[model samples]
Target: MRVPVVVKVGLFALAVMGIYTYYANSIPQIQSALPEEISLEAETVTPEQLVRVGEELFKGKGTCEVCHRIGQVGARAPDLAGIGGRAGTRRPGVSPTAYLVESLLQPGAYVVEGFPNIMPRVDRPPIGLNRSELWAVVAFLESLGGEVRARLDDIPKTAGVPAGEAPVAELKLPGDPEAGKAIFMGKGGCVACHKAGPLGASPVGPDLSEIAKIQTPEYIMAKILNPAAMGTVAGYPAGVMPPTLGQTLTAKEYVDLVSFLLTLKGGA
Candidate 1:
């Protein structure tokens, strides 16, 4: 049977369209339905008030948008879209908001899986945050995580000590921003994943444009040593960040590395 050329063309086009639609929608839907075996407490906030406050805090003084991604703008970090979902499977027993608080206060405590542990410690900066500012930043991060699968309430609010309060620092190495840059790229191994100015690092992680202004030293160190402990925050996959490479360095090295990290502050 000789089919008309137009008929054959039309059928081919329809088949192609059908395949595209199925791949685009159905695959995702089925994957969503599949059991990922995740465990994460959902987040709860004041809604409009928290979101508005978080938006301003994140974009403004927080300067989180510089390295981290929110609703467009910056890059060098993972997209915040559906952070709640990512955290659930990746960080079991961790709340999205709590995870954010930990990340800000201790960037090194729990490095995301698959990514290099490169986020400089926030402690390098002298900007010690008061209680209110800390809460505000945490709130903003939680908002980004959005409503998770399990109710956040299910997870204990006090999963760990409040961020920015840990006495993790023992040595006193006066930080030099200039020297810190060298240490970051050199011994610290931070240059492997983080980019600074013309010095480009790997895209597998976030950038260090103006991290000093956004994070506290305590937060930075925690992220360095144990990012998994921080869980998932700002929707970055908790498992994505590696644990702090503390075992790799000595006490003095830790102090020196931290001092160098502090100099990375100020707007990029």
Candidate 2:
């Protein structure tokens, strides 16, 4: 069928416009609407300059490496490998940036479960950090996941003891499994580890819901009170566990903690 020239051209134009509209609509609207992840590349500062300024306060004035590790081998501090992703999940009620800032400024608030609350609160005098220096350490910690892109020169190279030096003796404290749960979740902060059925636990540390099935109450008590004696595993970091919890806890608290820990069971 021979169509009129003007009509033919009009139909062709309409078909083109319709095809354009269909394809446009078919494109994912969310992709177009969503914002790209902005690169947080540092401003143009020399690598040496960044390290000097960053490490000066961090390792020297700040003394971060005293407890924290950069390359997975320091004493009493959770290794900072993949900490940029972990800090958010490990400690609830904290984002990556906010968690980093809060940790530096207030070290004891939400401790890395199983570790002692020994990290003196940085908010107090004689050991406080101003805002900028704290953030710089955060930036450096956030940067440590991959190859250490920054020069950690200021971080002293002294080799720390492979494991914590705390002595490990039989747990003298006595408590029941039922009672231990109370002290654990309440006083001893045992909920930080030993999760079962979504009750209380943290992945950065060990799970104790099945300890009773595996180890005796005395063994469990000794291990809990003296984590250094227990040693390390794949997920759990070594030496970071506080071996002095026995000293800090009362006999009753110890009993209660041990009692609660024994309640953990495998296979539900």
Q: Cα RMSD to native, each candidate?
A: 20.8, 25.6
> Which ten-residue region of model 1 has the weakest summed lDDT?
29-38
Q: Model 1 scores what on Cα lDDT?
A: 0.50
Question: Lowest summed-lDDT stretch of 10 residues in model 2?
Answer: 30-39
lDDT for each residue of candidate 1 in 187-209, tens digit (9 for 90 to 100): 76778877765566676555655
TM-score of each predicted structure versus truth = 0.40, 0.35
Segments in model 1 whose C-alpha atoms lie over 4 Å from true places: 1-58, 67-173, 176-179, 232-244, 266-268
Measured by TM-score, the strongest candidate is 1
Error of 1 at 150 (Å): 28
